[model samples]
Target: MQVELGQKIIDKIKADSLSPKPRWHFLVREWLVWMMGALALIVGAASVSVMRYLAENSSWAVQAPYGQTFAGWLLLSLPYFWLFLLGLFLWLFYYNLKHTKRGYRYPMIYVAGIALFGSILLGLAFYTLGVGSAIDGVLGRKAPLYAHVFNPHIDFWSAPEEGRLAGLVVAHVEGEDTFRLIDRKRGEWIVTYNPRDDIFVVVGQPLRAMGTISGEQSFEAVRIMRMRPGREYFQRFGPTVISVSGSGMHRNK
Candidate 1:
């Protein structure tokens, strides 16, 4: 009875002209699954790196002017769209990894934790290497809608009445502590400064200032920040990573 049953199964397979798939077919599928997982991890890392760039470049030390706590600033500064991308790619990474040949042995939570942790680790490395700022520069210049969406920096400094101002140095006297500027909206400003700020300015360079609106079309700067077209950005303590290669108004002292 057992012999007859086995023979019938073999006959069915032969009659249907079915043949076993080649070994490489399954191998390729396995490799593809692993590749997809790795790609997802890399992209998730990029997303995290960008988020860190925004946070570190934000007005983290200048919350006094905004009247908000550190927690409040953190909540508001987070990029929800980027956060969503991070979560989405994490899921992709987890899903692809779990489909691998030996992946089924691992618990779901283990895979997910690895995905999250790996992304964060790689993201930190990317941040330290200035990849985040470089990506930000590309997006800021290439993506037209990015300015409209990421307008916090511009909006915050536009409020000259609240002791904040930013614009390009349109004119200035050589060796003088004052300059003329035009804002993003093309409005003119007369800005007086101090040399101790360490931010040497020249015509056509955009700058940020905080102090008081001195008078009609005039302003006084208690502190000033310089923005240039490079990878070197200023931190409150000193020069650090990040830059106006895609940002403005990043220092507080």
Candidate 2:
């Protein structure tokens, strides 16, 4: 009888050891959170790279300065904003998964609270960054303009003749700063600088001008306007009529 009883006890122990254990919902939840965190990190890195590239290379030689300014605005507002949001979500997801598994059952009110708090922080940050400046420009509180300056450092074209004007300011506009120029025949043309008065170019400075027929001209009226430095002297709605080749200045109208 003793031998039989010892064998029964040993069998019970073996059965207990071999039996399948119940799944821990918390472990699964933690794994999912980790996956999400990895994804967010990858996306954030990609976003940073793209934003940097756009900020640096978005414009032609003359347009580079203005492009950089606009890129700064974008970096402050869009890319960072999205990155913060992603981080917030990742944090909340992790918190929920961790706390819930620890046998602490809390309502989702905590998560909602956290999200609200994060959004408020993001709003405050945006307000501090001069995003309001863009809004003000739209509201007409300030006139927004873009300026491009020629860079003598880079080679833009393959043709030797085209190289003469490579670093020269090609086309500039004040009222319409975002205008694009295209060659109808070759579809190749250089972008010139278009600086805003308040932002890039200063007042009382000679503005540079270059054209296909006209080599280049430096004039005094090129002084940046106190209020609208990038705007042309005439303040016309369309392209201004500045002297391209001759000593005389004439309006396109």
CA lDDT of every candidate = 0.72, 0.35
Lowest summed lDDT over 10 consecutive residues: which window, candidate 1? Answer: 229-238
Candidate 2 lDDT over 36-89, as tens digits, reads 644544343333333332233223443343334655534332434435644665
Clashes of 2: 12
Off by over 4 Å in 1: 1-9, 148-152, 200-205, 226-253
Question: lDDT, candidate 2, residue 44?
Answer: 37
Model 2: residues with Cα > 4 Å off, grouped in runs: 1-21, 58-253
Clashing pairs in model 1?
none
Model 1: per-residue Cα lDDT over 87-205, one tens digit each: 99999999998899888899989999999999999998998898777877676555554533543354556688888877766666656677777776677788898978645565555
Collision count for each candidate, in order? 0, 12
